[model samples]
Target: MGGNHAATGAAAWIAVTASTPIAFGWYPVSDASVFTGALVCAGAALLPDADHHSGTIANSLRPVSNVVVKGIEAVSGGHRKGTHSILGIAVFTAIAWALSLLSIDTGDALFGAILIGPGIMCVLLVAFALKALKITRDTKLLPWTMSVTLAVLIAIFAPEEWYWMPFSVALGCTVHIVGDLITTNGVPLLWPLKFRSPYWMRNKRGLELDWMWRAGGNLSLPILGDAGSVREWIFLIPVSLYAVTGIVWALLDQMGYDTMAIWYQIVAALPF
Candidate 1:
């Protein structure tokens, strides 16, 4: 689930960025923004899982993470409850937005470009994303090092604009929820606002839509049957390919390669 969510996050970011070779132009495009936003999205994709005490994000740090996980679990009314809901997305985005504002008052950057608040946010979140992606599971040092290095680079070279940061967080979380909706257990997307199941939903044998009302509206589609199922893996193939392709294309374009021309050549060379 973490891997799938992470890939989806990157793909979602690529889909929104105009700077990428295959995307729309919702936000202003830049080499730095493109990559930074993708990483942020990947990290935020795993953010909702913090509610699960035994999940990846819970043990992401150590004792501190455990305490934080317990707090979130309690406040969120257990896993797949508040943190998986629309309200949770709003709360997460608001927090990210607030941290982004901290950069505005920073007359002197941390390293000539790094804003303390956003820089710290990026470091922690990006580190979490690296952890969730299992980029270096054998040792935690690598991810932390990579995150710090990226943060410093962003501070030094990336632009100061972060208007798109909070929304990226929101999009990542929403993508996570969507991922859950495809699973058999589903998620309470509308926490604390359960409704009676309609005739169609009530008649379904496996899904207890009305029964789950107390926990929240457990809106699910069950297309993938269950988490980590073989069907899920099959579904992830195309998504993973898209994420990889977008990332590679973005990087190539950043390195000044003519991606469009290459894509055209690739198409032309393909067998009919």
Candidate 2:
């Protein structure tokens, strides 16, 4: 589910950035920004699940992650409750926006030399992404190192505008909610306000259903049955591929490679 969430997050970012009719071209950022935002979004996709003590993100680190998870669990009113809500998304976006303003360059040598603001944010995000994607499994060291390296590279070469941070966070978190909404256990999008199950979904005999409704219950489509179901895989695989292809295409386009021209040449050479 973590991997699936990450994939959806990346795919959503790509889709939103794409200049297509379906996307509406909301974010007209540079190719580099799109690529960077996609990675950040991928990691943030798993952030809402931090309320689950046993989740991959909660267990990714040691005492720190455990402590954070406990805190989130306590505040969010258990797993899949508050952290999966609209309020949670707002909070996350606000925090990201605040951090985006913390960058320092020039005058302050310490801040200028070190990747303080968005750098740290990017490091953590990319690290979590690597962990969630299983690219740095069995050890946290590799993810940390890779994250730091990418952060450093971004600080050196990428543009300084951190305006996209909040958007990426919001998109990632929202996509996460959408992903969970399709599972057997749905997320509470509008928390702090309980919702009764629609008459058709009500189960009079089950105390669990009653409790869920009372605790600002879940909102689900349940098309995937459960997390990591075959349906989820079937849906996510193509999305992940689309994200990868978009990233590659963006990079190539940035390098001034006209893919359309190559495609036309290939088509012309092909047999009719």
Candidate 3:
């Protein structure tokens, strides 16, 4: 899946999850916490594509991304290898869970450092030094790094409820894998037990399945197609409607509105 589509899918998931009873067990207590969890999920959604050197995440992270991508590619042998597989999601989930187990107090201290004078200055100085040295050809890298750095700092300092952090990250990763399943070259979902997209969805010359993939693939354009495309709408409309309904229902419930009663009233007013 394109980076933008992955992001949109993740956002839609977050919105729907936030507004539904399904996520009640994992829900955070505060709005700020909810937003933090959503952001983490969104970032994690882009992590699998870290192996694609030209990918948005990689372009955003620069020299660090170059190193990270190269390392992963070396071990995995190419794009859509380990990171796009079931094994990757499990490993990442485990890592997130382990990180969650760390003393919250320690995270708080590091968070403080990231926000304070010396910590902020240290980051700025390093960025400046890197820019002056021309160590990276991508000028956007500095700003992207700074933005990501600040986001991480906020996540650490402000801190959502512990348990949901890992869950949100893992959910994001899972969403990414699912999104890639619809692409021209479907993801290696099962990895060692490789299989292509089901027969119904397979590409075959002159067949409907082939045409579907071609259209969907074109609509899956990462950033641009996300703006507004019929193909995108085909996927987005139903999901967006579902998510909006959930969000509205959740909001009304929180506000003490009798949503069911309002729905009944609207239905009664409708002409037969």
RMSD of each: 3.2, 4.0, 8.9
lDDT of 1: 0.76
Candidate 1 structure quality by residue, lDDT tens digits, 60-131: 555566788899999999989889888889988898888876653435554354455666667767877777
- What are the per-model numbers of colliding residue pairs? 0, 0, 0
Order of the predicted models by TM-score, top scorer first: 1, 2, 3
**Candidate 1 lDDT trough over 10 residues, lowest sum:** 208-217
**lDDT by residue for model 2 (1-272), tens:** 88888888888888888553324467867777767778888988888988888887775655567798899899999888888999999988888888777755655544354335777778767766777889887685677678888887877555364568788889999999888887877777888777767654455454345323423367777878788889999998789998897777677777889866775887799999
Pairs clashing within candidate 1: none
lDDT of residue 251 for candidate 1: 78
lDDT of model 1 at position 138? 45
- Which 10 consecutive residues of model 2 have the lowest summed lDDT? 207-216
Better of 2 and 3 by lDDT: 2
Question: Which 10 successive residues of model 3 have the least lDDT summed?
Answer: 215-224
Residue-level lDDT of model 3, residues 1-272, one tens digit each, is: 34344444335444645634434534434443344444445556666665676655555446665776778666764677778888888876786676555443444444532323222322332332233224433676554576457545654555444446556657767877766655445566556555433555554545545322333222122321323345655776565454345545656666678867887887899998
Q: Estimate every model's Cα lDDT from 0 to 1.
A: 0.76, 0.77, 0.53
> What does candidate 3 score in Cα RMSD to the true structure?
8.9
Q: Superposing every Cα of model 2 onto the true structure, what RMSD results? A: 4.0
lDDT for model 3: 0.53
Q: How high is each candidate's TM-score?
A: 0.87, 0.85, 0.59
